[model samples]
Target: MGKRSRWLLWMVVAVGVVGVVATGSNGGAGEGEGKGKVLEPVVTRIAFGSCANQSAPQPIWNAIIDFDPQVFIWLGDNVYGDTKRPFKLFGKERTFGPWKNAPRFIPSSPKELESRYLKAKSNPGYSRLRDTTQRSRWLLWMVVAVGVVGVVATGSNGGAGEGEGKGKVLEPVVTRIAFGSCANQSAPQPIWNAIIDFDPQVFIWLGDNVYGDTKRPFKLFGKERTFGPWKNAPRFIPSSPKELESRYLKAKSNPGYSRLRHTTQVIGTWDDHDYGLNDAGKEFGGKITNQKLLLDFLDEPQDSPRRKQEGVYTSYMFGPVGRQIKVILLDTRYHRDPLRSDGSVLGSSQWTWLEKELNGPKSAITIIGSSVQVISNLSATTRPLFSLESWGRFPKERNRLFKLIADTKREGVFFISGDVHFGEISRYDCATGYPLYDVTASGLTQAVEKAVPHVFSLIVRFVAWLTPTTMRVISKNCRFRSCTYGQPNFGAIEIDWSTAPVTLKLEVKDIVGYPVTGVKFSLVELQSRGSVPSVKAGEHRRHCSLEVNLRWMIKYRLAILFYCSVSALLLAMIGLAYAATLAFRLFLHKCKLD
Candidate 1:
């Protein structure tokens, strides 16, 4: 590399570094490791978002803090890393090439990745927050069984203890869940505060956690690799484990993300960007290493079922009986097949597991999460219908999922998805069960009107902007309100179990936490609805009753008073002891003089 070329290369790297550091923390747990301290809170408030550019301004984090969520979810696009490749700005070759034939990128050595993670942690904003907040790390999925919130202790070194007699047990119950996707660290993101305000107990990351494609032709090889007519700038495709680790490290050190992690319990899965490339599947050779990196980042236990699998699909049951909430996170990437005319998405074993999970006894409410849309067809919005990344591309599997829900007669089964750059709530009616509602919230930082992958994308976006109705037409089954497709946004699900039948409130909010749209469903109502019902979601939204709020306030005040009284008593005793000691000393002096 020439002096100018070397400078330019450093400049690009500096751009990513400066971008994250400008909005990052001063310090954080290194190697994506943190100690876990278990707290058994009865109800949890959760927050989730995605598509964050580590180097971008994240004002949304402030608003998220205000809501006081107990947990946060990084759906995907948490960071854009992958030093192996450079993003092609313009050309016929825009999309990533095949993995097998792709060239390897440099400067993505293990040391380089570690340095990225370390620098990201050094960002001032994240450092301050992480330092003060109570944080822990461990496998969150397997431990979250019915009525239990299992937490593992975080050693001083931010790793799990290898001491003798370590066991997993049931702990606490979760009550709130927030989720979203598609964040670019270099893009504008002001959506986090709104998520924080929503105050979810558990945040579910749908996918696209980080756009970590590092496979740049020029950066990978000495010369800029040219592409044919069909390809575009190649996505950052990491061919080795080292490149993958670098991307993750960069993401973890994001300032806004650092703060959120400090304040709340977080868990998530991966999408294309963080997994290695755009629209990658099982054919990606680095699946094993990537899985380990992702799991380690999420603090998965060594004995986690995820460790035993080739992909990152897992399930958790939370809350006690009568209020149990089962969450099933699906891995759409690891073992996925190519998108053929008749294609398969979830491989055979995952399918078997999904079937088994759905067939079993159901929770009060069951949430099935997919990184991509399960019931949306954009043929209405885009002409010629070019890209099909959603479940719509795999009709057989999609129907199988619907059929399984129907066959199980599961009452509160619903889907939460994120992958598209927009947000909406779609419903799928089942033959034997209630209609399935898929809440699609995406792009914590990045949003687009259409899903077209090429230059025509600009035109599709323009048309969608001109005719907003075109976008709504694409979501024919949307139940809550109109779709949010123009700017950054997020989605939330609030459950109230105090009533005889539990109630679920679904919401899609803008970057500032304003409710763009919302809907409510009684568990009974959700179970009975055979088809899409004409209901006003705004009116039916289950609100926290005044009685409950007031009662909680009273109890909180009493607790405070009790604490004050105890503190005062301790002070009085200390004072009394001090005075007595002084008097004794005076008496001793008098006796000696006499």
Candidate 2:
């Protein structure tokens, strides 16, 4: 071969080698076929360490920050506060220069530990780590400062009301309690004025007290109704405590809420939106900082035990012994495991606390406040595609709660909940000892009907009707066929001690304090072994079953059958397409042979 031919052959060989190298670099073929392998710059990086001696050099912090971990877990002993120091046991006993006594290792006093923590916080290297991980970790100095404030407010004698009376109790014999949830701070909250007009002795906030975490404009049919290109885009994302604090301030500053706060004792627990994330659970990183912000909004004392605790669960007793009412507010956000895991809604600690509260001091009426519905499980009647936040999602936990109530035989027990964005009353009588009632009031300013277009009102009504529980239905005030009021509403409980048997009324009322739906019963009807007359009378007892109207199913049967027929038709078409492709390939092969 000539020189030019040899040169061309070498060039072709070089190009082939380059192609092979490119394929390997692009992960076309490699060890393990590169299926689950992660390349450089991994998406999520986590770093953790312990036993950081703040007094000594902290050069490792700079390198750790440089690594840019998405999460940095400080296991324990972030600072060496329990340090060793030389002690002179015999004070002023004329010890020799340095050979008299040896150094002793002693844990630091509270003040000294605090000073060491402050010193560690001021370290420049640690400050860089804090700046990088600001979204996840609460600042060490801020937590310490809050602790100091808590101690000062609580005092040595525990003057801040440590236990059951931690919440405000306005009445000696409480007869009226008003509660609601799901209020948007930016919207007009006239419902507060109505709640105050009812003259409720106590007011409870179930959750979603403010829309701190919402972004994106209200959309209808997946399109923004507002006139802007970025209307569908997220307007704001709350990543810091400041954002949540500002929203809380806006809600607290509402004139109506302020007046209600003064007129009645206000107490509350949080749901997902106010808890800093939608559908968030124990896994949310900023929960510690956000908890402080929530307590601040509630005007919790600087030294309240709630500040130091992991959750905000607490109980309050009002009135004298004969007419006493106990309100137990549960914190469902802080330690809640994820949905569908069947893990836990209330963590083990909260559950233990709940059992104690249930078995604690006797009261004529015991009201348990859960941020999510306890008795009404929408999953049973609503389509399986939809998932709502409720205790129903955790079946084991729900059963345990019921069994606890039965074992304790806590009489006059009923649940008040919010978060479903509608007003209704549910009752369960099977596992529970008595007719367990859950009065749910939601949408103080934000309602489901308002979120969608007016044209979709009928569809919303239909969906509500299809979802049937042991819902207590009164007159036509519950405009929905399923006895659910979707407009702005609140729940009210009234106890008439003047009656012979002491009548109790549970109501879901509108903005003007008009009863939308309610139930009237005697206090004796809530006993564990007592025979409830309402149940004997054959009231709605199927709690969370698939029972629905046969006529309604017949009306929609054609639509349901169409889905099945279309699925079969698609399968037939796919088979025909596969046969046609095979026949075409055979024809091509035969033509090539000819």
Candidate 3:
């Protein structure tokens, strides 16, 4: 090839380097793989999102259905946010939004909520989930039989581990869980089946699986754990589990839940519902107590990560180089300082720990989980109540986070978040720093108007404009930036880590598997800077090819002036060819005639 041709070919190869190619290990753990530490390099793809009110994940559920993922992380707000109820343990019930004003004279405490649980557990959805699995049916039958055999064997206490606050640690093999918000169960049912059928290594609960939030204002520890997670059994109160949360989870773990029980290892952290505090953090005085209560609900063996950290923060490792994904769940609310320059997203201890983690990174990919939007430039302020409750709220901390990732040179970092009642995908350029991509999933359900923050829609629009482009406002969808915890939705993050230059995709869908307007972009692992670079994106409308432009000419009139010269050379060559042909023909004429 000519020198010029070689250089042009090289340019094409160089351009191809920036675009990411997705390939990776078949995330499926080998059949009959023991439920121990998977020593084999794990090629894992995870789906994460949060803030789903238990109504029906409308328009958004489709995303979860189509994106059949391996691990689904529930960001938080799992149930319609039932606080003050017993750590609710019914099957599952859903509330469709347009947010309803909570009822007055709410169940006083766990005892009261237990009664409610009895009523709610009768829900069709709840019943199906509870009685779906054979093992679950057997357990239910056993619970009944054991109750009948009580006193003779073990006195009033009934059967073994009955109502005993001490939870049994069932080290999981593979668990299958259906992901859908509230009444929207069928929406992502296929995804759930895939999880079960495929039987991955783990499953996650992102949060907002139910919506039993108390309408009346609840003081810290206002309500208590209510009723048994199952049916009419001993209504005993152990520590932990907020009133409604207990009932809600019990309902979720129903026979329907059994299908998922022994399938895969499950781990999760809550964003809102389980705690009943929307967008709440440590700053909200109620958080510490809520955190403790949540710890109680998750009370597993001491070795369980949930019990160990018990904070809203945690991490998990998956796979080798084809991809190595490390997921870091942040409390955004727990240890965060104010948005001041000295503010902090990570508390002192967590910060140090996070720094240490970031300090050591050569992994193919990393993901950060925050229930609320982190990269979205918009805030939820239709009014102050719906005002910004995203990472943008704490600019100082947000910037610092960027600096940390960039300085640490961590690559393949993405944030999977939810809570705005809507869903979106965004890539942020830190003015000129590392690249951070944040994907928000708000599928599952919607909010009733005038939820919390009482953000006025008009005010919210103004706030969107005023909101600095950098302050959590990543897109033009005004609703996306705000903190409206009213609407419900399911969220998910899909990662392809089987090949070099890992690929991560963020998608949100309504309960029925429909459209969720969003964007997707990727980069080679080695080429990606932890943060979005400040380089301005080329904004030209008129299309122009570099080669075409380069070949056009150098100095202004040179092309026009040299045009004749070029034409002359071409003509001269043609003339020479004609003359030579004529001369040859003259010689050939004789031979031709012959």
Largest lDDT belongs to which candidate?
2
lDDT of 1 by residue, 463-578 (tens): 44332121122333333234445457788888887777777888777888776656687888667555532324222211111111133333244345556778999999999999
Report the poorest 10 consecutive residues by lDDT, candidate 3. 540-549
| Candidate order by decreasing lDDT | 2, 1, 3
Q: Going through the candidates in order, what is the number of backbone clashes in each?
A: 68, 3, 122
Better of 1 and 2 by lDDT: 2
The best candidate by TM-score is: 2
Candidate 3 lDDT over residue span 1-594, tens digit each: 112222322333332221112122225647543222212212245566665544443334334433433345667644343443323223242122344333322434676556554654454333333333333334333333332233123333335465442222111111121222231222223334333433334445555444434433323332432232333322222223355556555644543334444333454456655544444455555555565555444433444555555366777665433356666767665665544334666677777777888776566567777766666644322222234456766766777777787778776677777555555555565422445666566534443332346557555444333332322324343334442222344444455444354454444444333323344445463344434433224321111111112222321233344457789999999999999999999999989888
Q: Compare candidates 1 and 2 on TM-score and give the better one.
A: 2
How big is the positional error of residue 515 in model 2, measured in Å on the Cα after superposition?
Answer: 1.2
Badly placed stretches (over 4 Å) of model 2 are 1-171, 217-237, 470-477, 530-541, 544-594
**lDDT agreement of model 3 with the native:** 0.46
23: Cα error in model 3, Å:
40
What is the TM-score of candidate 1? Answer: 0.57
Candidate 3 TM-score, C-alpha based: 0.47
lDDT of 2 by residue, 1-594 (tens): 112222333333333333333433554576655332222222377889999887898888756765666578989998888866655556554233454554366678999999989999888667655654652233222333333333334333344445533322222467899999999999988777578668786789899988778575655435544323445544445556787899999998886676555445678899988888888889988788988888888777677778998988888887765788989999998999988899988899999999999989889999999999987776544533355778878888887988898888799999999998989988876655578889999979878777789999777777677554444443465645578888899999999998889999999999888988888999988877644333333233455231232234543443455567799999999999999999999999999999
Superposition-based RMSD of candidate 3 using all C-alpha atoms, in angstroms: 29.2
In candidate 2, how many Å is residue 134 off?
Answer: 50
Candidate 3 wrongly placed segments (more than 4 Å): 1-203, 207-213, 217-245, 254-264, 283-289, 292-300, 305-310, 337-342, 380-385, 431-434, 446-488, 497-502, 523-526, 529-594
